[model samples]
Target: MRWQKSDVDKYVSAKEYIDTLIIPLIDFQMDQDLENNAFQNEVLTILSNELEKELTGRIMLAPSYYYIKTFDKDQEIVRLNHWVENVKKQPFKHIFLLSFDPAWKKSEQALDASFVWIPKIQSGDIGSKEMQHTIREQVKQIGELIRSYW
Candidate 1:
């Protein structure tokens, strides 16, 4: 099913740092009202719904990361490791780290999770061939990774 960070709010803490999706938007572009918690929840809803339709029950869409950027990589790894270890003790075979920020490529170390890349859409760069190819490639890579699980 499609999933989102807010959907897992009950499982996580209530803190400003618990937000994961808006930082990339703010870091890459102007800080618009879209960064508000309500707006972020809306985006998460839309994305989660779309993913639910796309993946169905074949893959359980775990919640998005709390925050895409971390002040300390080791701490981030430790937190993810805790979550992963919990899931590992369950029936899950793997976890996919869905992220649009390229910075995650660096912070993902020590986390036992696969990844789904979402290309960054900078101002004036959304529809460019570069973005298109990058997004397509990411989609292909995510698909391949998921298929490998079977």
Candidate 2:
């Protein structure tokens, strides 16, 4: 649910997100140079295409989530409800989260939709074809479940 700032700072506001410490490594990539966003956009496009093909359209993406240093339950509820309403107005059937951390489970109410937890490869090493196939099958199984429920 959270985006590495380096992944979205150009498209979104920094105040509304979680800052990953590792983004420092990509800090240079966030420059105001035109090529920066272009490069980022290309990666996003490829990733989006890969995800779309893998999930077969069962997945729904949300704006990134930020941790509140001083949490406000009411404000959080309002924001989440708004997001839910916005998505419901879209062409989506179900919403899911590809989260490496379980804490993101709290956002389940944000979209008022079903969810799936996709595993992460923190090593940045996605392993072999077998591993990729396993992840694909998991996503496909989730897609089938979403279709069955919706």
Candidate 3:
């Protein structure tokens, strides 16, 4: 299920069976690395969508959690935890935070949910067949990892 009206409706109807939530953490920064950051977001979005599709009824795909790139990870953790706390009111038992930003790895222990850091694709033509294949493989691996937690 995605973060859309119809999906949420389905999720509400089957809330008991859907025990997992996936929150994509997106980093947006205006700097010389803007292009790379944008690329990462695009790839991560593709991966998230693919992962959701692969695990349809068992997981709810939350809206992408966007944050400005900053050195203050503690502040971001607090904000992220707030989101987690709110969502925890629901019945979700497994909450996964997905990101391509390597910085999250350093603070994973402080996160309220499981943090998955995907390796960033430095540069690529997202529409290319090779890229699509890569994304598909990644989605499979991530889907398997998530299922392992179940």
28-96 per-residue lDDT for model 2 (tens digits): 123455564344333333333345455432332344434342355456547655655565554334444
Across residues 48-126, which tens digit of lDDT does each residue of candidate 1 receive?
4444444443555555556434356577668767777776554456566665555657655555766455644333343
Which 10 consecutive residues of model 3 have the lowest summed lDDT? 67-76
Superposed Cα deviation of residue 120, candidate 1 (Å): 1.6
Assess the local accuracy of residue 23 in candidate 3 as a C-alpha lDDT between 0 and 100.
97
How high a TM-score does candidate 3 get? 0.97
Query: By lDDT, highest first, what's the ranking?
Result: 3, 1, 2
Model 3 lDDT tens row, 58-127: 9999999999988598999999999999998897899999998889899899999999988888899999
User: lDDT for every model?
Assistant: 0.48, 0.41, 0.92
Model 1 spans with C-alpha error above 4 angstroms: 2-45, 68-70, 123-141
Residue 57 CA error for candidate 2 (Å)? 6.4
Ranking 1 against 3 by TM-score, winner: 3
Pick by TM-score: which candidate is best? 3
Model 3: which residue pairs collide? none
Instruction: Score candidate 2 by lDDT.
Output: 0.41
Best by lDDT: 3
